[model samples]
Target: MLEVYIDGATLGENGKSAASFVAKNKQVCLEGYTFIGEKTNHEAEFHALYFALVTLKHDYSDEILSIRSDSKIVVDTIEKAYTKNPAFLSYYNKIAELITHFPHVFIKWISDKDNKRADTLARTGLQTESTVIQSCS
Candidate 1:
């Protein structure tokens, strides 16, 4: 069983956007970042999920996964409690596509405070063009 925590950050005016992931036992991180040129916070959030899932797919072939994030919309959409907005359906669908590969997938929501490491990493990724990625490979 593996647990993952992820988060994304988007600054003002294509300033910076990043996705950061932390796996169980505080072992390494899987992180990514890009200059959005111009995008919204919501888009960054989706990017976070996208990159996180992709990382999981490449890193773990046949393992059940549990993903945690601080994004309520992401959690709710995955849980089917809230309807996916038409504007975001495409991105959501993309996310859903990758999720199908997992034997079991769980998305959980936690407070921002509890997710500080991932959040900070996301912000750091955005600030630095280096695109920091740490993971126990």
Candidate 2:
């Protein structure tokens, strides 16, 4: 089974957002963090999960997966496979589609303390955005 930890960071509501994930098992370890432009925190959270699933599905399609995130809103929405909010429903729908490629996916809600690595990576994405801007000037 592959254990995936994910996190999303936003500078402010409807502000710059970052998404990150770490996926690992005995055979492999993979991770990614990126600035995803302007989005809400919840949107960023979903993006991280979706980004991770897309990254894993091709290579680890046969493996059972555990998706871990610190956002209750994101985790709850995914677990139910439904959301009343039109904004969130879009993300849930996209994530649900990607899920069909896997054998099984278990989503877990974790504490921010436990998801430090992914959180750090997500914040780094904010710094990366800052760095890119500084270098361009």
Candidate 3:
């Protein structure tokens, strides 16, 4: 089974956000982070989940997935497998599609304190974006 940790963060007045995910097994660890331009905290969280699943799909599709997130909104909605909000539903739909690739998937909500690595990666992404923007000015 692969354990995945995902997190998202937003920075600046424009809400430039970033998504980060880490997938690791006993012998390997992979990390991914991307600045996803402007987005709400919720949107960024979904994007993090998306990227995490995509990462696992590429190399661990057949393995059991133990996904973890600090966002209650993301974890709860995914557990229910439904959402009424249009924006959230959009992500939910995409996530539903992604789940088809994994034979076994389990998601659990965790505290922010427990998800430090992913959280830091997400903030790093935002900081990197800010650096680029600042350098351009």
Against the hidden reference, what TM-scores do the models get?
A: 0.82, 0.91, 0.90
Better model by TM-score: candidate 1 vs candidate 3: 3
How big is the positional error of residue 101 in model 3, measured in Å on the Cα after superposition? 0.4
- Model 2 off-target regions past 4 Å? 130-137
Candidate 1: residue 61 Cα off by (Å): 2.7
Per-residue lDDT of 1-46 in model 2, one digit per residue for the tens? 9899999899978999988888888877788888889999999999
Candidate 3 residue-wise lDDT, 66-99, digit = tens = 9999999999999999888898898999898998
Q: Give the TM-score of candidate 1.
A: 0.82
Clashing pairs in 3: none
The reply for model 3, stretches above 4 Å from the true place, is: 12-14, 130-137
Taken over the whole model, the C-alpha lDDT of each candidate is 0.71, 0.85, 0.85
